[model samples]
Target chain A: QQQVKQSPQSLIVQKGGISIINCAYENTAFDYFPWYQQFPGKGPALLIAIRPDVSEKKEGRFTISFNKSAKQFSLHIMDSQPGDSATYFCAASMEASYDKVIFGPGTSLSVIP
Target chain B: DAGITQSPRHKVTETGTPVTLRCHQTENHRYMYWYRQDPGHGLRLIHYSYGVKDTDKGEVSDGYSVSRSKTEDFLLTLESATSSQTSVYFCAISRVTRGEQYFGPGTRLTVT
Candidate 1:
């Protein structure tokens, strides 16, 4: 069973446009939600993260909007650039499980100039 | 870069053969993890260690074994290679269980 589910297996956006990817989790025990970005032939890197306590968190052009009650979270990239093209993964983990994260399949994003 | 390195970045072996991958870290982190990434499957944890000589199985641990005898090194071994085990393996380190995890470049393994 995929505990975490992500929408839009892939996405394409134009430069200067907004790019969004959504994710949802079935386990209410999840407390920490994080997003990772990966470039070709490299490992995934931490992009942004949020906790259930906060409804939203923003850093630079990346923002994570989380809804605890809905068990959903979304990532928004403002003014998407061609350089932003990469794969994004959303993950969830609870403190009790030693922070063993469960990740969504992934969303491949492409920003065209 | 968290000072993590994965040896044998690429490997190819035949079925029934044994394969081992190495992950080394200089960050002195207390936690280390091994994960496998595949298309449409995201990343699945194979094993993790919280301290030297302490390890735990992850969601997908079948046919896999791990060891952490030293703080700077963690190893993942495939008892007997199988085609189903082919995938990109990644090692991650964190200062604490809930802290941010830093990932190594990755090792692409192929079992024929």
Candidate 2:
């Protein structure tokens, strides 16, 4: 069973437009939700992360909105750029076992100029 | 980006052969993980180690084995390579204090 589920296997947005990707998890034990970005032929890098304590987190143009009650979270990119196009993965992990992170099916986003 | 390295970035092997991928980390983190990335399945955990000589299986541990004899080195071995095992494998490390995990460049294995 996939612990975390992500929607919109792929996405496309125009330059300077908003891009959004959503994810949901079934396990309530998960407390840490993080988003990772990966470029072609490269390793994934941490983009933004949010704990259940917070409703939202914003880092630069990347924002992660989390709904603790709904067991869902979404990533919003303000003014999406062509360089921002990449595969995004959402992950969930429990505080008790922080090492075990479960990832969702990635969303491939492309920004057309 | 952490101090993690995967050897033999790309490999092409015949089926039924034995293959091993090595993961070395300078981060000295207590936790190390092996994950395989497929086209539609995303990244699935194969195995993980918490300490030297301690390891555990993950969701897709079948047809694969792992060993960690030292804190910095983790090894994933395919007892007998299969065509289905052809995928990109990644290594990751995590610290207890830090709630984030860092990934290393992947190793692409192709079974022909």
DockQ by candidate, in order: 0.67, 0.60
Q: lDDT tens digits, residues A1-113, model 1?
A: 33899988999999999999999998887878889999999999999999999999999999999998989999999999999999999998876775468999999999999
- Give residue A113's lDDT in candidate 2 (0 to 100): 100
Residue A59 of model 2, lDDT score? 95
Interface RMSD of 2: 1.9
Winning candidate number (lDDT): 1
TM-score of 2: 0.97
Residues B7-43, model 1: lDDT tens digits: 9999999999999999999978888999999999999
RMSD of 2: 1.3
- Runs in model 2 with CA error above 4 Å? B97-99
Q: Which candidate is the best by DockQ?
A: 1
Question: Could you tell me the TM-score of candidate 1?
Answer: 0.97
